[model samples]
Structure formats: C-alpha cells, structure tokens
Target: MKSSEADMVFPVLGFTPDGDIWGFPDLDTLTSCGSMTLKKNMQLDMELVDSRGRRWLVRSIRRLGRARPLVPWLIDLLLTAVPRFRIEQVLEEMTPLTLEEIKARASAAVELTSEYYCAEDERDEILVPLLDQVRAASDVAQIHELLGLDSFLSY
Candidate 1:
C-alpha cells in the first residue's frame, strides 16, 4: 500500500525467508509477482527504540542468499536480500543530547548491539566496528551517519 501523498509505497504482504509462510491480513495475493495500489488502513512495523532516544519503525528479514532490490515502489524493502535499512522518514525531532546523555546513550547502544549481533558470527564484519565508533562518538551526528541512517537529516 502507499501513503496518502503517494510519495512512498509499502508492502502489505511478506513471505518468510523460505517463502513458505506469509503475513498481514490481506489474504488475496501471495505470489512474488503482481501490482496493486492500496489505500492505507494499517502498516506492519517492528519498532526499535534506540539509546539515542528515538524510535525507528523497522521491518526486518534475514537470510543467507543474495536478493536484488525490486523496483522503485518496493525499493529498500529489506527481505533476506536487503541486508539492512536506512531511515526513510524522521517521525519527530528529539531533544539535543547533552554530553552525559550522549555518553550514556552510546554505552547503552553498544551493549544492546553487541548482545544482538554477537551470536551471528556470519553477519557482516563492518557493522561491529561501526558500533564501536558509535560508542566513541563525541556527537550524535557521527553516530547517525555511521549507522547509514536518514538521508533526510540536514547535516
């Protein structure tokens, strides 16, 4: 389905990594090919609240094989093929982080990140170092940029 402005498009239906199971209430379409424009009633999202005191509406998938990005409408929809995601929109502006807040947030982020990605040694190596940079960052912008997030950010 698409936003009311028609500027962004989202998928209502998603299959598991094995392509065996599907999700969402709309049971009409399941195949990997098709086109339909839908008016927004709901969006499926898995949100993560980062230590930076912002909430990210995230959709995630994991798999081993390579997956090519789909067309413009479905672009950045991270299936197993899509490794990670970038911020499409900033829901709100948060208060500027004080030096103490920055340090606390960075520490918290590192701990969470390490725990989350620790078990999966098969994951990308670059991300591990990036988190370390985030921990050592003196400014929030550095952390945000290192995460490859939010082109909308006016830096």
Candidate 2:
C-alpha cells in the first residue's frame, strides 16, 4: 500500500554510528532540501516511484555535513549520560519499518544516486567513511557496538 503524507508521522530521519536514530517531524521547517528546482537537492527527497509506478516514501535520510559524525556522537553522549534510555521510546522516535521496506527504499535511493553521479574507479576516493559505517555493520547490535560510547570517548 502506498503511504500518503498524512499517513506518515516523521519527516526527518537520521542515524548515528551508535545506531541511534533521530526522527524529526519538523526538520523541514528548520533545514530543508531547499527548493525542488535545484538539481543538487532533488535527491534529498525520500520519494521514490517503483517500476509499478507506486510511490514509496523513505522516512530516514543520511545526514550530510562536515560535523555529521561529531553532532551525532555528542548527542549520543548526552543521551546515554541520562541512564533511562528506554528502548521502547527510542524505537518509537526512530523510523520504524520492516526490513523489506528499508531495503526497497535504500535500493531506490542507490538507483537515483547511481543515475545522477558517475562512479569513480579509484577505490580509495570512492570509499566514504560514513558509508563504510553502514556497510561494515551487519546487524543493529553490531552497528551499536561499533558506534558505542567507547569509540566516541576515544576521540
């Protein structure tokens, strides 16, 4: 079933190395993809149309900025400092979706990215450290462990 804008609750989705997820329903009000007119920012939209022409919206988007890692790391530190980090509340605030849903949207995003940008042959240049975080971790537990406080505390 296609989800309309009304049916979806969260608009902004972001992830931390510690597998911390932040869902901001009002992010667009603060930061925006800018106008859809600019080719540069168009891909920021989570909207994707499938082969069947069904539109699917991905709630989460990778945060891009120089301080992306530092910001999430700081937030994680502050959040963990407060002991009562309820998993249920985290899950509720996070973008909750089935594995299939995540896969579909992820594939769609890759498709769009691949189409827009040319792939580089130099493996080193192509390999992004942030993307590496997602690629290296196989599961949620692994992601959290890799992104845990111990790692951030070092830096």
Candidate 3:
C-alpha cells in the first residue's frame, strides 16, 4: 500500500484487555462483514467498530498505531461475560491511564467514532462510561444492561 493509504491503518489507540482475547458482539446489529457474530472469542477476519463508530481489528493496528463505524467494540464482544480494556501501549507509559484520559489524548481517534453520522456524539457519551464499567464488570449479563444491549444480546 502507498504511504497515505498505509496511514489509514495505524498507530491506533488500541483499547484492549490485559490478556489475549478476541470476539464479535452480542448486540450485533452493526458488526463488521455481517454474520460472524456467533463465532464467540475467536479472532476472525472481521472489522471492529467502536461505540463512536471507529473501525478496524485488534490486529489491524500497525506497529506504529489504530478503526470502522459506530458500534460496540469487538474486544468487549470477545469477553461478553466481563468487558475491560487498558490502552495497548505502543509507547509504554510509566503508569497506565484511564480510558477517559486516553480518549482525551486520542481526541477524535478513539473518542469520536469515525463519523458514522447518527449517534456519533451520543456514542462518545455512552461509550467511555460503558467501557470503564466493562473494565470493572465481572458478568456478561451486567454488561448487556449498559445500553439495553440485553435486548440484542438475549436475542
């Protein structure tokens, strides 16, 4: 790929679990490539869209960076039972930062979804807190309640 096209791929501000996890979504009306939602935690060749509508996959990130649309993240989907994430540091920090703080640094990168149109702003508001909760949560059922995802997760 050309340098410009390659730039579209990385130095992503990846928010991930502290372990090697992978997934699709429970409330999956917006999953990438349509219809891989049943695969559970396997790393399929799927696109990941964040709540703010960013898209890409956990592995898509270049050694340098960071996405698709406005939907719940795949990592959260991977571990439906308990959602959690820490910034996957391409540049290690002395101490870890919170999702909100990292979002602040990433600005439009991770905070504002890749302009999916409707619900972009709302996604940011709903997203951070939900992810924070994901980091702390211990049950899938509880995560579903974050945005009434239970409506879909249970379906």
Candidate 4:
C-alpha cells in the first residue's frame, strides 16, 4: 500500500471480552467482497452506517494481538480451583503498572499534545487531580465515572 493510503485505526464494538484491547482498519475493502452476516457461524458480521449515509458491512472480527488463550484459561481455572485467589487480587497483580506510573506516562503524553494551550499551573492544579483519578481507576466503570467528573467536563 502507498504511504498515503496507510491504515488508520478504527474502533470496533463487539460482545467479545478482548475487543477493546485493539482497534482495526480496512472496513471499506473488507465489506466490498460480500455480506457475510447471514452465515451465522464462527464469523460475525454487522452493518454500520457512515456520516454520509453510506452503508457498509463489517466481517470476521479477530483478535488484534498474539493470542494467549492458554494463559487466561489457566487463570480462569485457577480462579475456580483455588480458594485463596480472589478476582480483585488477580486484577491487581495482572496490572503492569501502578496508578502513579500510569499518571506520569499519561501526563507526559497530554502535555506534549496540548501545544501549550493550557498553562502548566492550570493543568497541574485542575487536570492533574482528575487525571490522577483516571489513572488510579481500577475498572472500566470507574474510568468512565472519573471522565465524567465536573473538573474534566468543565474544561
């Protein structure tokens, strides 16, 4: 593919557990072949409409990264088999970084992208605490709630 036609990331919504982990591309090309939704086997298909009212069919959603089915299966087995391992403990242990580490990395990225739109003091005083909560979030719901907080919404 030409550099100008390089793939752009597009978010996909699905019922699968790991769907949120990676995004996809090439929906237009994938759909032009045929509509695959009617088969109703392992493959999944869904219809989506663009802003311009164009209809498209999405087919065969697959995992984006290396499959580690065994690891998760083992973890699930352990969760059921072992009495001592709680889901909370497993989640904490599985998380690669602490909230503070997440905060630092996110802050660096945000500052770089902000283009000096907000002053350092304003960002530190207002945004940092909100982002601190965002980084500290343990679950998806918590992250969404934190994002909806007044401090984040006001700015």
Using TM-score as the measure, which candidate wins? Answer: 1
C-alpha lDDT of residue 149 in model 3? 25
Off by over 4 Å in 1: 1-71, 74-96, 116-135, 146-155
Model 2 ranges with Cα > 4 A deviation: 1-7, 11-97, 115-118, 122-155
Q: For each candidate in turn, give its C-alpha RMSD to the true structure in angstroms.
A: 13.4, 13.6, 15.3, 18.1
All models: lDDT? 0.32, 0.32, 0.31, 0.31
Cα lDDT, model 1, residue 124: 51
Predicted candidate 1 versus true structure: per-residue lDDT over 1-155, tens digit per residue: 21121221122212122211112221112111111111110122422223343333323222222122435324544232222222222222224345455445544544455544355663457545666676677654455455433211111
For candidate 3, give the lDDT. Answer: 0.31
Estimate the TM-score for candidate 2: 0.26
Between the candidate structures 1 and 2, which one is better when assessed by TM-score?
Answer: 1
Q: Tell me how many clashing residue pairs each candidate has.
A: 0, 0, 15, 0
Cα shift from native, residue 98, model 4 (Å) = 9.6
Comparing 1 and 4 by lDDT, which wins?
1
TM-score-sorted candidate list, best first: 1, 2, 4, 3
TM-score of each: 0.29, 0.26, 0.22, 0.24
What lDDT tens digits, residue by residue, belong to model 3 across residues 1-155?
Answer: 21122222122223333212222242122222212222242223323323332344433212111122224446544555332221121112224344444334333332333233236667657656655665554333233343232111221
Span of ten consecutive residues with least summed lDDT in model 4? 84-93
Give a tens-digit lDDT track for model 4, residues 40-122: 22123333222122223333333222112567646744564421111100000112334344334434444454433356668
- The sequence of per-residue lDDT tens digits that candidate 2 reaches over residues 1-155 is 21223233333333333232322333232122312212222223334322222333443333233222566646755665421111101112223554344333333333344422236653345434433554554443333233321211112
